[model samples]
Target: MDHAETITLADGARIATWTRAGPAEAPHVVLLHGGPGLWDYLEPLAGLIGDEATTHRYDQRGCGASSPSDEQSVARSVADLDELRAHWELDRFVPIGHSFGATLALAYAAAYPERVPAVGYVSGVGIGDWRTPFRNERRRRAEPFAARLAELSVPQRTADEEVKWRTLTWATDYADLTIGLRAASAMAHSPHVINQHANRAVSFTDADQIGWAAAVRCPVYVVHGTADPRPAANALQLADRLARPRKRVVTEAGHLPWIEQPEQLRELLAEIVQAGRC
Candidate 1:
């Protein structure tokens, strides 16, 4: 929360960036929030790190405060990160990515293994067949709101209705309905639009992800939540592919561990930063 600025990419896309001050010699940690289209929402998670490590977070091109673009792909996103690291003058850093962002982080590491000391993959849906099970579990959990959710999911919806629809849909990501509803409501921030094209274009299948993992030369922390409907087994699949993967599972946590288990996630990230320093 200390600094904010906008950086222009080679493609002329403007990306909004933020920074939190930490020790000059501390490990640099770049946080990648999930969603191919959603804006940055890792402020709380970033706050947990405090001054332990210098942190940089930004809206992916065409998301949040970033400029929209007709071109979106995994390669472009990885290139963007490398550009940002150069702009930030970071020699090396750890990329902690959540959800889809986790996949992006892995791709970055694979593309530039020399610049990445480690990677944090949190709540990621690995390149496995987790989508089917996730959908089934989400369907079971969302039975109470199914009718309304379907109604609001139509092509045209008022802004308010869109938020409602998103809340109901995302609420299924939590194990506790009460906390899930509250957290999902907060995540339903304004200007929220899911870029279906970006989601599809920037994603990787398990087969391709495995190929990418082969190129990664650093250690990867594959962190997952036990109660996260996405199936922790998917995380294991990703871990198995990494050259050096450390898997951690948070008990009773849904998708976003920072919300339900801030201290635990904080400890894990702190450990990662410290390890990167060594």
Candidate 2:
């Protein structure tokens, strides 16, 4: 693994990061991890991108080792990505966004389809006309999570304090279900910063997000799961919207299929990148 070095933004935020196996000359790849404040924790698929892709993984504004959010909001997170791409002068990029990262990637592709090559959208949001379906599926899948969350009370007097408490202790509070995000958040971003970022991310909503995804001309590969509780029907709905040439729905994995089905992910990715424009 080649440690992710930094290219300071004009705003002067020191972002922590690293890159995985690929030559400097190879085509650039930007791997997007979900979990708004989850940090840069996706390492399983980095090696799978092969030699042709120079995979870049970095902490979001307030996650991982990256600089804390400049403004602590979803708009800022999206802006950070845009700013980073501009700063790097990257002509074309392959966005491999997983889970929540998938939603962000779709938003980016929809907003700036010209900057992207193709998208490896894995178990992402249902940004098509499947909001009700996706929402129901999320409710179904998130039930267990929500149940667990319900059991572990936010240990605060008021809703504001609860949010603050969780914001500071998200990694700890949701440690088990989230795979130790508390320590990662603590090590990478502070509670205040993570909470602010979460506030922005949770508040993120755009009716045009789905409209943009529908209008995007770029090819998309959707790797969804059969057993994974989250977004089950939404995946099919999204693929249906894109149709065959630009879509693929994996039947065996769950929310994070890159980790669950790496080979399938690699094959689909290779197919998409090799197929070029639809």
In terms of lDDT, model 1 sits at 0.87
lDDT for model 2, on a 0 to 1 scale?
Answer: 0.61
Model 1 residue runs over 4 Å out of place are: none
Per-residue lDDT tens digits of candidate 1, residues 1-278? 55998998777889999989898888889999888877788888679888889999999988878888768888889999999999999889999999988998999998888899989999988866898999999999999989999889798988899889889999999978789999999888567577777777776677778987899888888999888999999889878988899888887899998888888899888877776786
* Residue range with the least summed lDDT across 10 consecutive positions in model 1: 189-198
Off by over 4 Å in 2: 21-25, 70-74, 127-151, 156-202, 240-245, 275-278
Best by TM-score: 1
lDDT of each: 0.87, 0.61
RMSD in angstroms between candidate 1 and the native structure over all alpha carbons = 1.1
Model 2, clash count?
10
